[model samples]
Structures are given as C-alpha cells and as structure tokens.
Target: MLNYKQKKNQPLKGNRFLISVTVLGSSGPIRFVVNEEDLVGAVIQTVLKSYAREGRFPALGSNLNDFLLYCPISETEALSPWDNIGSVGVRNFMLCRKPQTETAIDVEKSPSVSRKATGSWKTWFNNALTLKISSH
Candidate 1:
C-alpha cells in the first residue's frame, strides 16, 4: 500500500519515454518525449504539432482521422488510437496515411499488373508442367 504523496510523485519518476516518429518519404525521423501512459492518438497529435512548428506542410489534413500508426516489424498489426504507447511494447513506428478510395482506383488503373494475379498464373503454369511430366 502506498501513501498519497508517493502515489502523487509516481508519475514524476521516469514516467516518460523517448520515441521517434517518421513520416514516409520525409527527410528523417523526429524524436519526442512522451508520457508512458499517453495514448496513440495523443502521440499522433503531438507529431502533427511538431510538424506544424517546423513549417512542414501536408502533415495533417481534414482527413486526419484516417492516419494510422503501423509497426514495421509486425506489418499486419496496427496500434489502436486508445492503446497506450508503453502498453504496445514498441518504441518506434511509422506514421502512414491510409489510402483513400479514389487513390486505390488510380492505382488499379495503372499499367502494372496485380501481384495476386501474377502469382496465380505462375502457379497454374507450374501445375501444368507437373501434369505433363507425370503423363509422360
């Protein structure tokens, strides 16, 4: 059991952690001192503020809610806005802008073929070769 004074001073003793925020295609990452209990949303807001202070444009826009924090190591997992930074067990992550519907359509219209379709074609060719060899 802790007393009131101890509890009040708990957060003052090494409660903050240093983390890096990198915008994709940007010059470099910026370091920030953030409270361990701060949520992902708060960290993002801090990042936006820092960018603004540095005169970086397109840092945030009307669709600010679409941005997400993604851990490169665990590509499939994304940090939730409500989750605390310390709780996630990661000190670094990339701030990625979620692709809008219109952007995705533009990507599809490009000349490059989809990887999934190419992969299926490769599999079909391999299976056909295997069948031919087996028949012979």
Candidate 2:
C-alpha cells in the first residue's frame, strides 16, 4: 500500500516526449518537450514562445495563424492545425510562415506579358542547356 501511495504521488508524464522544431530561415532548431495529445496549432504557439524566450534571431512575430507546421517527409502538405502532434508519429517538425497570397492585379498583369516572358525563358533555358551539353 505504501508503494502504491508513493507511486501515485509521482507526476504522470507518459504522454509527453521531446520534439525538435526547425524554424525556417532560423539558424538552428528548437528542442522542447510536448504532450502527444497536444494539437498542432498549440504546438506552434509553444514553439514560438520558446523561440522568443530564448531570443533566437530573425525575430518572428507573435502571430500563430501566420505560420504552418510540416513534417519533413510530407512537406508538400502542412499538418492540419486540428491534428494531434502524436498522429504524425514523428519527433522532428518544420515551421514556416504561410506564403503571402498573390493579389488579383498581379494575376491580371501576368496574362498580358506571359507570351514575351515565355519566349525569354525558353531562350535563356535553351542557351544554358546548350552550354552545359557542349562542355561534356
């Protein structure tokens, strides 16, 4: 009974594990422990806090919604904010700012100049390729 009581008094930390999150454009990754059941969005917030606390460089602002988290293996798709970190089953993650959306005016301008841009691009590419092939 005494052993059981002593065990009960100890903190339960089974669901927690250390994870390393690499902030894009930062010099190094941030290592911290987190609960497996914690949501991805929550994890990002925690990572940001830790980064700022440590005074890491490139001063990322404090906007949780401005960032996205990804597993290195599945980089094409960011992990959903609603998903649990444990669901990914990976200890390493990458955090990057959400890409800024292009404005409608930019899209409209592209179509008018696309033909000229394509011609220049093709010419530049062909010349570069030719030089490389000729050197071999």
Candidate 3:
C-alpha cells in the first residue's frame, strides 16, 4: 500500500496538479494545487480565496463572477467558466476582472457648441500667430 507522502505530486493517483495564477494588478503569481477536473469557475474561486489569504494588495472582493481566467497563449479570449482547468494544458494562467461597461451620461451641450469651441480656439491661435509674424 502506498502512503500519502509517496503519492504526493503524482497526478495518476491523486488527480491533482499544481498551477500558478497571476492576478491582474498583482506583483506575482499565486501557486496552488487543483484537481484536474476542476471547473474554471471553481479554480478562479480558489485563486481568489488564496489571494485573500495571502493578504495581497489591491484587495479584490469575493465576487467570483466578476473575475476572468485567461491562458497566457490566448489572452484575447478568457477561459469559459464551465470548462475544465486542465483542458487548457498550461500550468500558468492569468486572472483579471470583467470589464465594466461605461455608464451613459446625459449631455446638455449640442454638437454645434463643441464645434464653436474648437473654432474659437483655432481663431485665437491664428490671430496670435499673425500678430507675432507681422511684428517680426
């Protein structure tokens, strides 16, 4: 019979693998062991917990849905929350927050107002340049 110590780091028997997740805005990556079948969402939750436990800076809140996990190779796309972490086949990953949509603001000024502002600046600049050139 194999002991727990002997089975450490053996994926065949333990199904656990070590992976490093770099939190966005963090100074360094946090390493942890996770099961191969773990979902991406679960991995992200674990990472957030570990990040908080370590007392790292830029304290991200406990909202798991707000975070995203991305593979270094495919940074343009974030891993699906339903996908298994092991499916990415990479030990290193990046965690970042989902971008928040900008709030719409009601503007009282019209387009003509902005155009007049720009035209007035140009007129002032041209007049200054003409005066300087004529004086010299």
Candidate 4:
C-alpha cells in the first residue's frame, strides 16, 4: 500500500491504473481504470455512475456518502475520502452500504441459535450410542 510519503511525491494527473471493485450483492467485481491522483470520493462516484448505467443501483438521489469502500481482506477498516486511490493500493476492494443500527443488531443474533442446535444434535447422538454400548 502506498503511504503518505509516497502519495506526496506522486503527481495528480496522467497516471492511471486498473483495479477490481466488487459491489456487495452485485453480480461480480467491475474493473476500473482510475487516475492515481483521484480521490476516493471521486472513485466512488465513478463506480456509482457505472452501476446506475447498468441499473444495478438506484438514481443519483441516493447519498453516495452512505456507502463505504473497504479492503475485502481487512473489512474493519474503511478508506478515507481524502485519500487518493493509489495510496490504498491497486487491488480488489469491496463497496457496501453502511449498516443501520437496527439491522446490525439483528445480524448478530441469528447465527448463534443455528450453531447451538447443530452442536446439540451431535452431542445427543454421541451420548445415546455411548449408553447403548455400555448397556450391551
């Protein structure tokens, strides 16, 4: 990843690189040739425009700021708008809508029950076989 020092020395124009961006829930990753000096915000705008053309996203009325760009491998970190694309490295990244507070709560609750049920069945089956063998 390019750091602040490298970004400082880079020119704002004439440098372009291709990167893959996967829009969460979309068909697949889209390849974009972006200028090295382009801000993250501008890059997102370009992505949104392409999605709009493809009818993958709604009209421009939607707030672009509500979406975030994340490195898929390190999803917890979001790239800042002030940072240029080159600074983040030219690689595959993810675009997702920021989760709402209510939806976030629901997401946390649904998986544990399924896991518990699966474990419980395995434990019960093993105990039953153990008891049958002991009695025999």
TM-score of each: 0.60, 0.68, 0.66, 0.60
Best by TM-score: 2
Stretches of candidate 4 exceeding 4 Å from the true structure: 1-14, 57-61, 102-136
Error of 4 at 71 (Å): 1.3
lDDT of each: 0.65, 0.77, 0.75, 0.67
Q: Rank by TM-score, descending?
A: 2, 3, 1, 4
**Number of the candidate with higher lDDT, 1 or 3:** 3
Candidate 2's displacement at residue 1, Å, is 48
lDDT tens digits by residue: candidate 4, 18-73: 88877765766678898787778777776777878777743433456777787755
Per-residue accuracy of model 1 over 17-128 as CA lDDT, tens digit each: 8899876545667689877777787777667667667866555652346667766567656678777777877788777666544357766797485433222222444786
lDDT score of residue 100 within candidate 4: 44
Q: What are the root-mean-square deviations of the candidates from the true structure over C-alphas? A: 13.3, 11.4, 14.9, 13.1
Deviation of model 3 at 21, angstroms: 0.3
Write the residue-wise lDDT of candidate 3 on 8-127 in tens digits.
574553378899998876879999998777788888888888999999999998788888788878747889988888888899998887775533341344433432222222244478
Residue 17's lDDT within candidate 2 is 93
Task: State the lDDT of candidate 2 residue by residue for 16-123, as single tens digits.
Answer: 899999887677899988777777988888888899999998999878888889887784688988888888999999888777676688879786653333222224
- Candidate 2 — which residues are off by over 4 angstroms? 1-14, 106-136
